[model samples]
Target: MKFYSPLKNTICGVLTAGLLAVPLSFSAVPSPAAEADASSLIGAAIGGIAAHAQLNAVLRKYNDTDEGRQEYFQEMKKQLGVNEDYALNHQLDRIMTNLTAGIGAVDPSIYKKPYHYFINNDKSFNAFCTLGHNLSVNTGLYQTLTNEDEIAVVLAHELGHGQKDHPAKGARRSLNMQILGAATGTQAGAVMAAVINNRNITKPMEREADALAFDYITHTDYNPGATAAVWQRVLDLSKSQPSSFQQFLSDHPADSDRRDTYVRRLTQYSGGHVTNSDGIVKVNTKVFTTPAAVGGMSSKERSYFVMGNLAAAYHNGQNKQEVTVDGNTVRMGNQPIMTCVSGDEPADTLAQRLRQIK
Candidate 1:
């Protein structure tokens, strides 16, 4: 019943080190060949079928029973710790909902599954989603984000993963890579890296998620400028460090290209670089796991090894809990915790203010 949240894996790995240290900027510079296609993905050995099958299995199992569904939510609630501030949680929920209202209206069936949120107190920027529309946002993510538009970009990107089944899709992609490597003589350690290092399937997934995020936020009051601006901030903030090193696949995109994509998406939306955001947004969270249930190594274990090697390579360092919600209260075990709305501010108003730079 457990499922892995690769985006969280992606999120958690926000502060990574790179060997080549090819610094990038979030500006618009295009490339014809960098986009993803399943056929040309890695050598000619792999296809998308195996990956799809892997995902199908997870989807099927999660839907098989009420117990499975309950367990899925329970594990997530227990594992990803959250000290929820009701005022914040309620505000986030309302804003996230209102922002994505168009999507819900267009196809409510797509959202038949329940969605929840978790807020972690991490200072660094990271947000990720699980298989069943569960998402986690760092509390400080709001602090770093300059406006609602940027938050929309982050949340929408994570939503895109759930909508597109990117985590399972990525897992399937890794499974394909694993099979292809075994058939074609890839080295053991190298194969490990390709399969679960977050390297093989991440870049394409990132691009796809970015595209989906843009799609969701379009026509909403959210400004497209903020979309590109936040990523640019990422480039600006991380400039001193080495380029980020994800385990398996990476966009390795120059910041310029990444920013450019968002800009282009915005241009398409408002026919210009700047637009007034009249859109609303709201929230919730969870972490997911699919532990390989094997005789030997788990996917997480594989990453830990690769991450260790990666750290040893850089001689540097790196680094969830659980909670429950009942009606308007957030809790830990039997203890009921009280949360206040901080002057009774509406979610929409607070959300709007939170998005702005201090």
Candidate 2:
């Protein structure tokens, strides 16, 4: 439920004089070799049949029931302070609608049960998904995203976690933590304590999720490049701040290497096709049509009606102009203007005028 970084305290040293800071001494730093050795030992200790049995026992405690899922959701909600109803319905609805449309089609089964969305309202850009289609997105992330594609990248990554059954594996991990806590001394206890208190398991699970998500979205209209783009944006946003003390960086733990991983993955999937290039994936904006009416007489339709209206308004040196369609009126100016009436405008006429106006 509450995921945390395993090396959080070590990498970012303890608070001193009310300020969180990293210790400067290289001697205090754990060498990469030492960290790898600890990981191997832990992996071996938890690899045998005994560990599997313990994990199965813990997993059996909660599985395949509304009660079990409800308990899990409650725990996460408490930890994240998420509004369950709104998250499960509203935000998820928007995400599902966009993803389903973007992908062109999706398996109907994926939509049978409503998905959940969790936002921590923190300024850090981090997102993850759990079992049962539960997703968490940070508010700090929303601020950085320029469009829906960036958000899609985050959601698709989390969806990868659910598709790969990461939560079920997480149950086994919880068991491993319990065993390590009981068997080893205080250092192990500290590790287990961190695990129980939101320690991020750096044990290849998140990487697997990233890879799986990369694969999944490649089959859809969502550009795989958006994955690398979002991270690059986050990286740039971090440099603008005083320090990279944000939770997004802490929990997700991204670096230049990870960004390169996404780029490599995109290249591999695209087969030399650039993602954002015109020849690769072209968005068919013509697919979208204005609705019949907006508050009456197609006010929304007039928002994109004709180039004469646009040219008149533009050449008149007016910053804004009011347009009325029946009782409904909308202000228009710099935006390319068009109007919709009962009949459709001829494509050639509209195209010629649009070119002249431009």
Candidate 3:
């Protein structure tokens, strides 16, 4: 029930031992090494029993019933202070509403246990859906991502986790593993160690959530390209400010992989005009742009950004606008697609090329 502050920090704490603590008791002194080993084993057995019991009680109290779930939510709010700013709350509400409807469209069973969510005061780029469909979004996520579509991508991903009941299922798995480890005696605390290291959320679960997010976003009015854009932004930010995102990046899949996955998925919604392979942007089966390192992003990283812009333009009908050159910028209507640099073709030339190809 207890965890660290912020969301990711709290999850890391729980993953480590905040919630799954297996206290180890040791004798002051043992005359013989054999006796010492026996005493240690005994202590592990006792600790394992206590940890198992505690986890079971947690499941019953928090995941078993609606009343228990509501009680846990109150406790969570108290632990992580809620953000009461009217504007922020309203923004979160609007985003959540859209995401909820989108999720319901994909799987109406989501309505069975309607989500309860609030913005937490924590300034970390993270959000979580815990037991009982209770959700919390970090204020930092809002502060970092101003785009509503990008925000929907994140919330939708968390909703995916909730739809599959990952939190409760993960907890149950942890409990079973704890009991198994205790029974084995040789691998005491192995499961706890793994979870503490942030390995509890397996890669498969993350992939599934990501896939679900893609589906959810497509169903909503939000631009689906933002799914790839968000990860591309994260990858770019991680380069200059790695420490700022460690807490988030630690548990999720690699940012580049995520970007690429969503980038490839972009074709599904883009009508195949826009597609990316490894970060190379292709429009209408032709290389639209292969962006080089501009700003702090690598060539590949920058390409995803270009791909996102192209996907957005196509998604929102901006692609119908005339491709024009204004200074070094290429624009479709008022939307700035990308800037031409020294190594690249002239903006006017590129704009004309895009017009022909687009």
TM-score of each: 0.52, 0.52, 0.70
Candidate number achieving the greatest TM-score relative to the actual structure: 3
Candidate 2: tens digits of C-alpha lDDT, residues 218-280: 555454555665565555556676254364455454655555677656544434321222111
Q: Name the candidate that leads on lDDT.
A: 3
Question: Which portions of model 2 miss their true places by more than 4 Å?
Answer: 1-63, 83-92, 97-114, 177-195, 198-200, 242-246, 250-253, 273-358
Q: Write the per-residue lDDT of candidate 3 for residues 206-263, one digit (tens) a residue.
A: 8899999999987887767678878877777777778879978877789888877887
lDDT of 1 at 315: 20
What TM-score does candidate 2 get on C-alpha atoms?
A: 0.52
Tens digits of per-residue lDDT for model 1, 1-358? 0133432333223212221121121112234254545544442233234333443454454433445445555555666557588866775776578556745654465456655667766554567665456667767676555455567778877777767666556545655665453323333334224433334336666787777766665535454445565665555545543333131113435555666676545434432312212111111111111112122322332222222121121221110112344554333333322221333334343323322310
Steric clashes per prediction: 38, 8, 2
lDDT of 3 at 327: 87
Question: Of 2 and 3, which scores higher on TM-score?
Answer: 3
Please give the CA lDDT of all the candidate structures. Answer: 0.45, 0.46, 0.72
User: Is candidate 1 or 3 superior in lDDT?
Assistant: 3
